[model samples]
Target: MAGDYVRLAAYTGIRRGHLLRLTHHDVKDGFLRLDRTSKTRTLQLVPLHPKVLSVAQRLPLGISDDGVRASWKTAREACGLEHVRWHDLRHTCASWLVQAGVSLHTVSEVLGHSSLAMTRRYAHLAPEHLADAINKLT
Candidate 1:
């Protein structure tokens, strides 16, 4: 269950609070419909990664914030990753997408960021994309 929670966080890029409120109903038509976002209080839809779709189908994930925190603490300590925070899972999702050559604009949308600037931080992860763009001009 805890592993499912971590996978959902790392796959969807959903915030902890939003993730806690997620229900099976949110997983529809290949997208996770977040009706109420913590920051914007607006709807956001994130396409479900194929690897995580099965996990998302089992939502309301049956784990509380405390449960997640406790599990994260234990797992991190056991793995000597005490410095890692739960939110880093969200970053992991974004970083993976960026490193895969997904545009930052699309990544921002996937993360439901209010502005493109918020996604720029991940641009550095895909410097090859920049090189490809410049190469196109030659």
Candidate 2:
């Protein structure tokens, strides 16, 4: 269950609180409708990654915050990844999207970030895109 939660979070970039609040009804039309988010408290529709489509189907993840914390702690200790926080999974998603050449604007939308500035932190991950744009000027 915790593994599924991690996968869903990593794939969709949804916050832990928002993910916990999700229900089966939230999954529809190839998107996960987040009625409210912790940071912005606004509605967002995050597209479901094909890899996590099966995992998203089992919504209302059924794990309490404490349960997730415990599992994360155990997993981190076992794997010597104690420095990694659960929120890092969200960062991982953003980094992957940026590295894959997805535009910051699109990634910002996908992450439901209130501003594009919030997504800029991942821009450095795709320096090649910047270079490509510079090359186009030639």
Candidate 3:
């Protein structure tokens, strides 16, 4: 579970289940390949951070998503993150991307979000980003 947290924090980004299900073969040129894209009508390839790749090297080539989800859920609860959901880790990823000044479109790609509208939930947390954007429009 420590491994899962480290992997989740360092990886391509959430959909932890998606990451858990990823096989070594999924890492490709410039992106972490997804077998399916649910929210987005089209397929996506998330650019992987080197840390994610490093973590991947430690796991078995193909780990089951269900096991990862169950283990992560249980472990987080034990660690007193009683309310944490796997999806919230995804949200944290999005929020971090927003705060770090990554463009909305790029964050959308990182999180496999279908649109910037969906990415807007974290916009308020970017500290001066919205203000900067508003200034541009003025």
Candidate 4:
């Protein structure tokens, strides 16, 4: 299940509490519908990559998403990572998307954030993402 834990962190970027509460129904055909415990009372539906889809398709009914998350810390450390909290995966995913030039609105929606206000925190990453704003003067 250590591998599943890695997928859980890599896929939905969900925190331990919400991941634990995940039921079989949460893993649908194309999306992972996360009812996040955080503020904003929003339901997040992130598109599942093909790899994630394959994993979700094989999850036994009523499997605990949280147990996987909890197990990940030890495994991650064993894999030679340090101070790598679960939340760090979320940041990593978001940062990678931002660096890839995905729009902020898209990132906000994917993260299930209520507004771009929170997503904007990563806005300054990767100078290329901001080149459009800076290039207007030319």
Candidate 5:
């Protein structure tokens, strides 16, 4: 149950702070509404995948930011993933999305990035897209 929050962060790309503040009520109509965010201070709605929604719907989702730290650490150790941090989940989400052919512009929006510059870090994962773009010009 404790680890669910961490997984939610990964699946949704919501930061730790905003994720901690998320309530079940915020998850309505297949979307997660972030009424407050660290970066923009504006309400942002991120579409929730059905798997993410299922796990989220069952939990209270009100755990403190530090509440899941010990569980997260334990989970990492069990998986021999001691090098990973919770924040890395966001990077994983973006990376997965980019690899799956989702556009950087859409990924940036989903991650609530202020600009495409921040999302560009995942650009390298989509070399095929670049090649396609270059081929299209010919």
Candidate 6:
């Protein structure tokens, strides 16, 4: 049902193309070694959430982008998740990390964003954490 792919996207925030291009050698010691061919055009070592480590560890290296997209569309429609694109899983990953109190800088690194600005969009999800940070200044 594409749950494995969905889980990886939601936990790693890796782009569809990167995920499709992933090979076993790219993952080791809980980090994904993304190459320069990725969307960011930078090499990155994104940490894998423990919860999804098994999925990523076993991820097959042969999946194609079109195959995943078609399967995802069908799976989402079947699950009544309308309007949810494959990329939305990455957004969900970022949003969840921010909500869970992970720093934007860390999330930026995991998402392979070149700068903090690209990760700022998830800042709103951590407002309470931000407020707590300000409170600690008192």
lDDT of every model, 2 decimals: 0.89, 0.90, 0.67, 0.70, 0.84, 0.82
Model 1: lDDT equals 0.89
Residue-by-residue lDDT tens digits, candidate 1, 1-138:
888888888998988888888899988999999885556898888999888899888898787889988998999999999999989999999999998889999999999988999999998898997778899995
Winner on lDDT between 2 and 5 is 2
Candidates by lDDT, descending order: 2, 1, 5, 6, 4, 3
Q: TM-score: which is higher, 1 or 6?
A: 1
Q: In angstroms, give how far residue 57 of model 4 lies from its true place.
A: 2.3
Q: Rank the candidates by TM-score, best first.
A: 1, 2, 5, 6, 3, 4
lDDT of 3 by residue, 1-138 (tens): 446544654455656656666665766674666766455556677776766665554444344656666677678878999787667767877777777888778888788776679987887877687677789994
Clash pairs, candidate 3, are none
**Count of backbone collisions in candidate 1:** 0
Candidate 3 accuracy as TM-score: 0.76
List pairs with backbone clashes in candidate 5: none
Better of 2 and 3 by lDDT: 2
- What residue pairs clash in candidate 1, if any at all? none
lDDT (10s digit) by residue, model 6, range 3-67: 67778888899888778767768889999888965455667888988987877777674566677
- TM for every model, in the order presented, reads 0.93, 0.93, 0.76, 0.75, 0.89, 0.87
After TM-score superposition, what is the CA distance of residue 3 in candidate 5 from its true location, in Å? 2.1
Error of 5 at 68 (Å): 0.4
Model 2 has an lDDT value of 0.90
Tens-digit lDDT string for candidate 4 (1-138): 546645665656655566555555888768878876567666778787776676665544344656665576667778897678778877777887788888888878877777789899988886774566878876
Tell me the TM-score of model 5.
0.89
How much RMSD separates candidate 1 from the native structure?
Answer: 1.4
Better of 4 and 6 by TM-score: 6
